[model samples]
Target chain A: MLSEAEIETLTGVAGLMIPASEAHGVPGADDSAIMSEIIVSAERTEDAVRNALAAFAEVGDSSFQQSHPDEAAVLQTIVASCYYRDARVLVSLGRKPQPPFPEGHEMEEGDFSLLDPVRARGEIWRKVD
Target chain B: MKTDPIDVLIVGAGASGAAVAWSLADTKMRIVCMDQGGTPDPTQFPANFMDWEERRNGPDHISPNIRKAPSDYPINDDGSPIKVVNYNGVGGGTVLFAGHFPRLHPSDFKVKTLDGVADDWPIDYQTLEPFFAINDRMMGVSGLPGDTAYPADRNNQMPPVPLGKSGEALAKGFNKLGWHWWPSDVAIATQPYDGRAQCINLGACLWGCAQGAKGSTDVTYWPHAKRAGVELWEHCRVSQILVGDDGMAEGVLYFDKDGVEHKAEAHVVIMAANGVGTPRLLLTSTSKQFPDGLANSSGLVGRNLMFHPYSFTEGVFDYPVDGARGPLKSIWSHEFYETDLDRDFVRGYMFEAARGRPPVNAALAGYEWGTLPWGEGHHDAFRKLNDRIMAFCAICEDLPELHNRVTLDPDQTDANGIPVPKVDYTLSENSKKMLEHSAARATDILNAAGATEVHAGYPIVYAGWHLLGTAKMGLDPETSVVNDWGRSHDVKNLFIVDGSVFVTSGGLNPTSTIQANALYVADQMKRRLANLFD
Candidate 1:
């Protein structure tokens, strides 16, 4: 249900966080349509908090749906939110979180081995904010 | 009125039943396994972890096992004579187990012999050691080896799950405190062993492991048995165990999925319907010869039920520590595993560093922010959730007493109109004492690990996980329904092979011990069969 851009971004983040290769032989974030599938299958649906943020692509850009008519900005927002939120959940479930850092600092540049941010970002997104 | 006959009839297809069936696979005798739940294809398991998260909210959250939908999934505690939490399909309790498998210590076997309290297990751990090793390999357990608490001959292979932060932190703290701890031995396959893939750290174990990394009998033992020519009847509820004039099980009467009665006769019947279900079935099957209940001559068929007291306490850590991302249990501490003279409790407690998946955390955080019924109050609660790190549960041992019992409710019945087991239970003085001691120690460990707020409590009333001791095994026929070999003392061919025959519950989870015991009994059953035929 998410917009193409938001889906792309979320998948991009999932790719970075989960990575294509890990201990479990790569549970790819990009291939995970789990959120989208769940949203479509719901008996009744509501706009989740994260979907609201997905309306703006990169802050300055118009909503992904407006720029690309075929896109589902609201859905993308919800999916991204749902995905990230679960990422946060993965954190609480006992995985160590990645260290927080300021923007444009090369998200992957930290000492990831000791402090895996993918799991942390996933935990933060899991929050209701 | 008429009875059909076979060699071995097994009930319930969970870990216990599956292991028993697997053990009996090589035998030429006809084997029939039955369960009251539908067999779900592994492919249909949910991919979304959020649905799993909501599942922890109990019946209120989105889960297929919601009480309104399935009669079997209900946590029936309606002031009945027996209260229990049971899963109705293939794999039984193994379907919902967190895969935390640990062997009950040798001291656990001789609790009475060593501690001067409770009844001693007729068979010691040494007698069951070979079976334990066999089951461990069959289940593909992943865990570190060489604990002094365990026998030297026991296998010590560790599972592939790298230790998580909580495990590391707790291990470090325990080392500093000189406490015994180890990476938990889990049924989850660490690597791609036995055709099952390794765990992806989905952190959603209780809702059922979709990845199949967490070993349940459905994936491990049952399929192999089925391949070797064992017939399985899913959604078939066994109602009565029919006995012959010679005091041997002649056959079993059960209702199929369509509510039609079907009879399967067996020379030897193994009751693996778990601690509660096994006793419930026995109590329901009252015959003319055994008037009180089938195999209830001692009046111990449904008595002496024991559920280990479970408690939880959490520690708060600085910064956002993502603790909800892997199998529920990754590590365990048995620092206080044995009886302690310094404490008032008879048995020790096992501490586990476990994961609480996201949706559960969200529900715990008190609903969504600014959403009606959940305003800023809820938002603030959600904000602080990430800073929590927890040393999850400490299972304290509870002694088997005659007073703590399970009985069939005359008024209540399952979908098939059979009486459900009503649980009439209370924490004995020893259990309460053990719980208090474990809670105090749990709080101390949390404080020592720099936890800001430590919360501790006893097992929620009727929160049944490890059902045990309903049909206990003992050397004394007057006190137990089954003998040391799990064969019924009263009936010649009926065997009780689940947790129901346990005289005492160790601080550890019951899955490994149950599976081991089942294998041992199955081996005995094979020998008995050869002797009868030859």
Candidate 2:
């Protein structure tokens, strides 16, 4: 949906939105694989993406960074949608790259002793006849 | 087209409709339920895909207006502070509910007697206690007994869902304040029960449970009701109730999936649509015998609409809370659930502790709130909030008001060309005060839980999950639409068994109580089978 120049501009904006971090071992939204997915998904929202790109080109990178307008929301949504679902991004967020079901995560059992104080207080509800 | 008359007809196939159908199935009466949406496909649930959060924000959104599925009917909620949120499928709202099942307090039935505000219910908690227990077993409820918030008879079929690190942190805060907090009773199965699998902590209960652990009516009551010989017709939108010459309900006129109109005749008709849908259908079903609407002789069919006004206070912690790893609802505090003269408000609210947001939702919320800017500091801001935040929602009890109502819109019509429901609602002074107090109290709890920062938003606009009190039940025919047994005061053979029959909105999730009421109404019908019309 985007030309080479527009793709380059989107990559720059995407990088600004979520920069690559070596400490977190996660790639930025501008990473080639993630950006490819974003471009593919942008087809579904072609008009919004084109409008956002036009706004970015008009404002320049510095001005666009200063002002996050309605157009920025479109880019942000597409970037975030692709960025968060990336395998490295999921791992960096401390989540498994897989879906929630069919292999759901395990949760620790609650400490029943936490209720001792509450149970000791007894019933707090009002009684009616 | 017209069909042969059946013994009983149900307009909706939701939580209440499924319960009523299952309860009456043993009577061997030819029962038929028609739902606009078909049974949900678990394979397509959001939890099954990597882009689940995207689906949740799109096609699987809670609001019918936003979801805009073929089965959904558009609701004109532009004038209301809180928008209407519901599902049109067989499970109804349960398809997207978090499964936090809490029963009404005994005092909830006698609000007028105790608090002198709303009218008391014709039947009290004692009358519905047995029915609550019956519904619990059928839905595979999981909870620990001996919650001091209710009578001692309360028990669940399985143990409670695990109160994860997030719940534990919130519990410690409640303990610090010496308040009443309990592991919430949930409709999700904790153990393998009734041929359903145990919960695997998918943390996606609200977006449709792919694990089949959550007890949505589709998995619980509908299967049993069908097994017991109840026939359910899906993708059929009921437009109006057909009135006979003698002023009794004869049947309903509905449009099927292909927009083919059909007349379904039944000796007895039941309206199990939600609060908004029920009144909308009634107001649109006008005739010469009833110039105003069907079963609306009292002129209260759409009045007294109540929604449990909700607010959220979230705390961002430094340590890992794993807030996105389990069921959405874990622990709840009833610290301010009852009325106290010391407070500014007459009625009170419950503090429901909720799990944190997923990655995509967290990013979007950060942008919407303007807390996380897009450039250099964005990553740092995201790290502080993602999977580390815990939230508490104040589910406040809303008093019934004459002005807050569901009226048929003159302009808007749904895909099936039926006039849509127009919601006109405003926050009452009492509800405003309650939200203010709840935000402060929730902040105190979050601060005590070792939070780095806390933020509060009152009257959450997208949190209109609980819709109630549009067609309330009472003894006086002049004041109420349905009787205590859910029988319509005007139309002898017509009944309403949904949340519309709730006299007052309690400070808890109403699905449990709604099912119990349906069961009670079914029991009453069975007892009065010989003289049902009397």
Candidate 3:
């Protein structure tokens, strides 16, 4: 479990990675409720985020946001993984965040015209007799 | 009271194990199938239908090393570039496979005679062709039948799934390039077949299908085999094969869900465990009778391990390509299936048309690739990378190098106190060259299709799905582990009917061939039922 301060900073980092743009209708890390989800759902992300923060502090002698290491990479994966999958973020990007089962997505019937050109030049088999 | 031995014992009721059991079901022999993992709970599938992407990194990851749920066992793959990605359930790897069912080229069987690099299979494609049709009927393939890329008389069970916008774009590009592209032959059914549901195009085939549409053996063969009176012991991991003084396998020693060990005896023991599990089971079953491991006198039990080295490329189109709508891979280009004298590599790779993953995977990938820019341009970058990307992977053919292998680790043991399989593998020159060529070709196709940007995963993180060649088949016992019919040369009553017996790793998803070989081996066993040990 991360300290409350670390969670806030990590949330802030997530915002930076995917900040809000009102013009593009995209939700930033702060706008979404994915931070808690990241902490709870990501595999060992809490430890990795804290370790990254410590590594950053030890390197830069300044707080977190210093020289990011492997731990930082792990944190970024966790943050981005949970954040982008959030329903709010997906909706803002004109996509559905829901899993594509039960009520499946609207898949347009394939345009058979795309295969017209392909069908013209058919049977390109290698002759190895 | 000790129980009497059954007629046959099959281990790991995944694709191959199920195929072998069903193939011999008509013989009216008592067959017992054992699996280390049990039936997937219906409650767990909704987690896939609900929190699909979020659950992947947490527990649904295909790799046992990452998805260390109760059903998985640890694998020490530190020695390899690509770690093992498989499951332990009744369906085996098919539980998580994309169900792309491309068959091995006829040329694949004659590698030594045609290519002169790897050893040739003792049996040719024609010998396995009938079984391929048989397995296709059983698995219910979905594809156009007359694609000249394969044999003219290919037996497609149903029309292929409809290609989405991304697939059409990729197809147009392949057409423009004058390449041989066709709708892939997948195991998923389009309509109801043999008591299973139809394809709903949910797009998460890689993460176990929740609709029970995809032809994973759990839904396909397990039901049929059970009805035919095959006894399947789920969540029972076999630790050792008990071979008597006569050097014939008597039965297996397995660990149950409660970590209790039990012995099941049978007249014949067939190890249908996959490439890694099969060799690990053999190497761990060492005794005074066969000091080097049962049927390992050839020392080829765990050697010559081959995982198809992969190269992935994606095209970023200006408009949204609704890639999130079909079977994971539908349209594939096999133009360069055979060797070209001008090419640097001996064998070639296949180009499979795939879509960008759902939002979560894409977001992670975009961040990792530095494509999803931060702070100010984040929105545009994420939008551009999200629904508009069409991705594809080049699955290259890997030849068997004796040094590339799976060995037993002495220190790391599973919950059952059996040695874990340690993989020692590296890319060969031929595979590297093939990948380089494939990546360049993929980039060309993407560019040809009027893409605005192109991104590629050079190492591709292709974590060894089509595991093959660990316990290969051959005519000579000194050179291989199993014979032509998958019968262990050292122990006649012992058989291996899985991808482990593949002499060569073909440039396609391996389940179809693995299943077909299972049918062939089962047929051979049935014909020789009177003299099975001979």
Candidate 4:
């Protein structure tokens, strides 16, 4: 599960990239956080994944980071990898993911099409983890 | 290569586009309606509330919206000035739009005459009365007409969507305040009009009504037009409206579903690509004869773009009102629907109430009163407030201003390398004042209805839902893009028959008016078809 700090950081980046002020409130920064969780948690039940993140954060409020302490480093690593990958992809589509893979697992190249502008808007949440 | 000529080329397949096709079906003209996306099916819509978000965002979630079917509609979203949020399909926005069909008041037409700010529409309500009646019957509007703020002559039979629980609660407040309220005249069938079934209170029209109740163009007019021999080219993106040397529309250049560029010559062209898309096509069609953009000699092709300003007001009751227990919304109030100069506003607003849904309700409640939905002590609070929270949203009237306009994005383009529509809009002081007045009035009504916790929405300065008046029609050729009959001044055979042709920003949702206006103008075009060969 992703950490709160990672979620907030990813949300901030998504917000900076796609401002709610610009998109008429459709894919705002907060929506980016939701989108990011949806993609990584696609294999898991949405509620279980969200609840797991909440447990990791140690807070009931989804956005608060102060409560969640243990899940910080892992979430940050995942988000940082995703963000770096996205930046690389921006320069050239379908770029390989950056090193520092989760638990030293070999990372594989993935389709960014899954992150369609409207759907993968939440992918920014991957930036903080 | 020679291109086949079409008698009529309709550029969009949304509500207005589909309506015009149906209106002109009896004319026996070879009509070709082109949309940028594929056609949607209503049968695949998700009905369960729990699974709605999955259906709404996931690829498998079949949209109940009568829009272009999904193929490979590509949109470019980089750091671009143009922020385009639109769906191109057979039914366009009508597929996604929350169908709250309320007719424009007579005062909506003569805004300048009544309040002296925006320009007046060339055609008044009386002029469009017959077409409105015709449109209502065709769409099967369900409501008690006499209860509306500005009631019209009962010229057509109405559908039977009886007042739901949410409507009853909202009506109580309006009745207590002695304000004019009514059941919202929606396109949903109440008693199974035509072949569709009655609305079983699905409460998810935005996603798509699987009950076959909501009257989408695909269900109502598209089939009718098809039966009448209207040729519809789904997944055809109309890029330009070509004008001949004789100052008449010649044809349209568009790309097929597979990205193959093709030209379809037409005797007349009708651009119904909505307010944003319609204006962009006209502005982008710059040629040697009209360098400033086709039909833009008046320099008002994309100017005066107006979107209705919306403000949501919520109320929390003592017991569980079970707000999210019925069809989205069945009741509305037009009590403060007037251009009251005393309120220091140029236009009016309509108040509509709906049962606040879960996530949104929780987020809003938390945002307004700093209450958390999750935690040990929050379950009771959630049950107490969730069902108790009902909303009264004010759809504020925003008159069209020339400075508030839509232009082609100088920075970004879509998949076909066409610049997306860029909207440069800001709320006027008059609009602000009108929202304040509406909000204050809504608060008063909510309080009267015994709401314990009331939260009013913030002032909207940059809302974009009720789009209208990008290519307005007027009697003066110099001041307007199209004539009163919706024929373009620059290109005689080109017509702008959508919300873009609206002269004034009416104080109502522009869909019904757009549909009605298109029907009226297509009828006029039907009479002028003989001039094509001559």
Which structure among the candidates has the greatest TM-score? Answer: 2
Each prediction's TM-score versus the true structure: 0.78, 0.97, 0.95, 0.78
lDDT of 1 by residue, B406-433 (tens): 7877676767788866777777677777
True-vs-predicted CA distance for residue B98, candidate 3, Å: 0.2
For residues B1-534, write the lDDT of model 4, one tens digit per residue: 224568888998888999998998888878889888777766556443323433443443232121223443332323222233345677776665666787777777776776677777888887788888888888778765444345447433454354544456666676666666656777877676887777666556666666666777777788788899898888888788887777677888898767788888887788888888888899889888988889998999989887787777878788655444455666676657765556676567788776665433343354336453222333334445655777778887777788878788887666677776667877688777877777788888888778887888745432355568888899887899999889888787788888898877666677888898999898877777767333
Q: Report fnat in order of the candidates.
A: 0.00, 0.80, 0.56, 0.00
Docking category for candidate 3?
A: medium
lDDT of 3 by residue, B269-365 (tens): 9988899999999998888988988889999989999998889998889888875677887788878778889998898888898876667667666
The lDDT per prediction is 0.66, 0.90, 0.81, 0.65
Output DockQ, candidate 1: 0.03
Candidate 3 Cα misplacement greater than 4 A, ranges? A25-27, A55-72, A112-129, B1-4, B46-50
- lDDT for B277 (candidate 3): 94
Q: Who is ahead in lDDT, 2 or 3?
A: 2
- Report the number of clashing residue pairs per model: 40, 0, 0, 18
Which CAPRI tier for candidate 1? incorrect
* TM-score computed on alpha carbons, candidate 4: 0.78
Please give the lDDT score at residue B504 for candidate 1: 91
Candidate 4 residues lying further than 4 Å off, grouped into runs, are A1-129, B1-4, B46-49, B54-86, B359-369, B459-463, B531-534
RMSD of each: 11.7, 1.9, 2.4, 14.2
For candidate 1 chain A, the 10 contiguous residues with the lowest summed lDDT are A101-110
TM-score on B-chain, cand. 2: 0.98
For candidate 2, lDDT tens digit of each residue in A1-129?
A: 688888888888898888888777888888999999888877667888888888998877644744746888888888898888898888877778988878998898879789998889998878896
